[model samples]
Target: MLKKLGQFTLSILVVSLYSNITSFANNKPLTEAEFKATKLPYSVMAYSNKYAHEYGLDASKAIKLPKGLEAIKLTLSKSFSKGYGPYASKWDYNCTAELYVDKSLNLYWPGDHAKVDKVDDRGLQKSQISTAQLEKKGKYWVPGPYASMLYDAYDKTVKADLASVKLSFFGCGYIPSRYTAAKDGLAIWLEKKGGYNYAVIGQGEREISSKDFYVFKLPQNLVNSYLPYARMAAN
Candidate 1:
């Protein structure tokens, strides 16, 4: 009986350790003090501070978006209607932010859908087009238009400039929907005269695409303002 009890305790310890490791792997945001301690480069630090200040980050709680920012509603193509369970597919679409500066900053909240839905006579849902379903099946549903718009807006606004900064925000599990439990984060794309650089904050650093993208992991508290929309959909 003593040996069996020891084995059970060992199993509990293993499970607890695994949970902690998984939590760490998900990449929580850094605290403001921790962020400062990192002593990131001036440009990166400055941009991050600006974003936090503008969005009003307070201990990673509720965030207040800036007033008067234009709202852009995103719509999915008609192909994602079927094969998606009702709970798996419902998302919020009204929380995006846009600004038209020398370059543009466009931020889409989580729960944005990538495809449209229509109900058939038999009460079954179907995508308007066959290709839309195929695209989702292939997991090719990342917001391509939004990304292109970011590039084009920056390109147009910073004509002849050496570089420019553009921001994009996503809640956990929104983009690349496969990672439903991903952390909320933001990306800053630096459009240089000859090349492009991307930095992500509030999540781990990794390459998001074949393009010259880079991720800078920061504490999720820094981006709490945009997380509610995603969280609502997730619930």
Candidate 2:
């Protein structure tokens, strides 16, 4: 009787532990209110990073963003906003401007979906942003020819069930090349049945092939600096 009672107690403890682990695994992304409380700038940047991870797009490179830049949600006239981009349908999806405080501004109208809980207020105040002022000071990183080629190869060749993939940023590095742009490498994680698999892109030589993928380690800061251009290439 005593042995059976002890086994029952151990089983109950194991079940309770498993339940707690499951709850943490499924915790929802931060809510809009929760994100706002942090008072951090760059909602779009945050969202893009999250998006990159979700779809296994590499955004591991460090970015040297413009100083004093911040994201502001604004309501613009329907006529002007219509010509902007696809991020907005009606005016309810206000434009999130990546503004370089009193300098340049680039606008993005993200959909009414929760990404990393970085929400934009629908009731955003009307815009003083003139159409002419939109891209005046705006500047963005551009990928070099080699990076662009790699991006094309990845986009055209890579395929996966994005929903099932887990984000993996194992860092990346670059080495100077005599012929092309710097040699680059990165590792990505993809989830498969019952477990995860490691895939890597060895030096930016030929187009990336699945067989050549293997893990490479380099400074994370190096990866971060290069990611802005990589993200641009992917886009």
Candidate 3:
């Protein structure tokens, strides 16, 4: 009789402990409200380094980046490479160029050429950024050749208090050549200050095949709030 009673007591204690643990887990949130308050700036590194880092390699190469901007590189899918250019190589996979204005910016991996999605409140919209408008410079395409197209589109499309903006270039797939080709790249513009705090120019969709110009805008207050945390992470 005593043995049975002790067993019942132990079972009751186990059930009580489990209930408390479950309650604690259910109440906890993924991230604290303070952490969500701000956005961080992202870093820029060479394509080779970023690729090597992803595969657990010791990447030591450093690529010079423009002022107030960081570099981003992406690799193309095997199937995409095989279909686009017969001479495509493993190195050719690292064709896309990425630049981040904020060093603490979050890292995102949206296969090949993904499209940007629409968001609310922060004043983000899709602009008509076509490859046809970009200028061909030697082997690569440059936005400097077609600044007017972007400015005109901004004036016609963006309805907000404009303050400051920056533009960068991105390549989608590998093209067979001594250097990156003009047609293989696209232009991206980001708005640093204005009605919105964070804005980016890239593809409108997040799919691997989509490649076009897109503008993303966010609130300045939201980004500023997270600056401290972002700085810590960068260091």
The TM-score values for the models, in the order shown, are 0.25, 0.15, 0.23
Q: How well is each residue in 20-102 modelled by candidate 1, as lDDT tens digits?
A: 11122234444545433432111101112223333342223222222212111111111232335445654332222222222
> What does the lDDT read for residue 218 in candidate 3?
17
Worst 10 residues of 3 by lDDT: 6-15
RMSD (Å) per prediction:
20.2, 23.7, 22.8
Off by over 4 Å in 2: 1-182, 194-235
| Pairs of residues clashing in candidate 1 | 29-218, 29-219, 29-220, 30-218, 30-219, 76-115, 77-116, 78-127, 78-128
Say which prediction, candidate 2 or candidate 3, comes out ahead on TM-score: 3
Which is the leading candidate under lDDT? 3
Tens-place lDDT digits, model 3, residues 167-198: 22122211111132333323333432222211
- Superposed by TM-score, candidate 3 places the C-alpha of residue 101 at a distance from the truth, in angstroms, of 3.7
Clashes of 1: 9
Q: lDDT tens digits, residues 52-124, model 2?
A: 3433433452232222211111111112245346565432111122111211112112232212223233211
Preferred candidate (lDDT higher): 1 or 3: 3
Report lDDT (Cα) of residue 16, candidate 3: 18
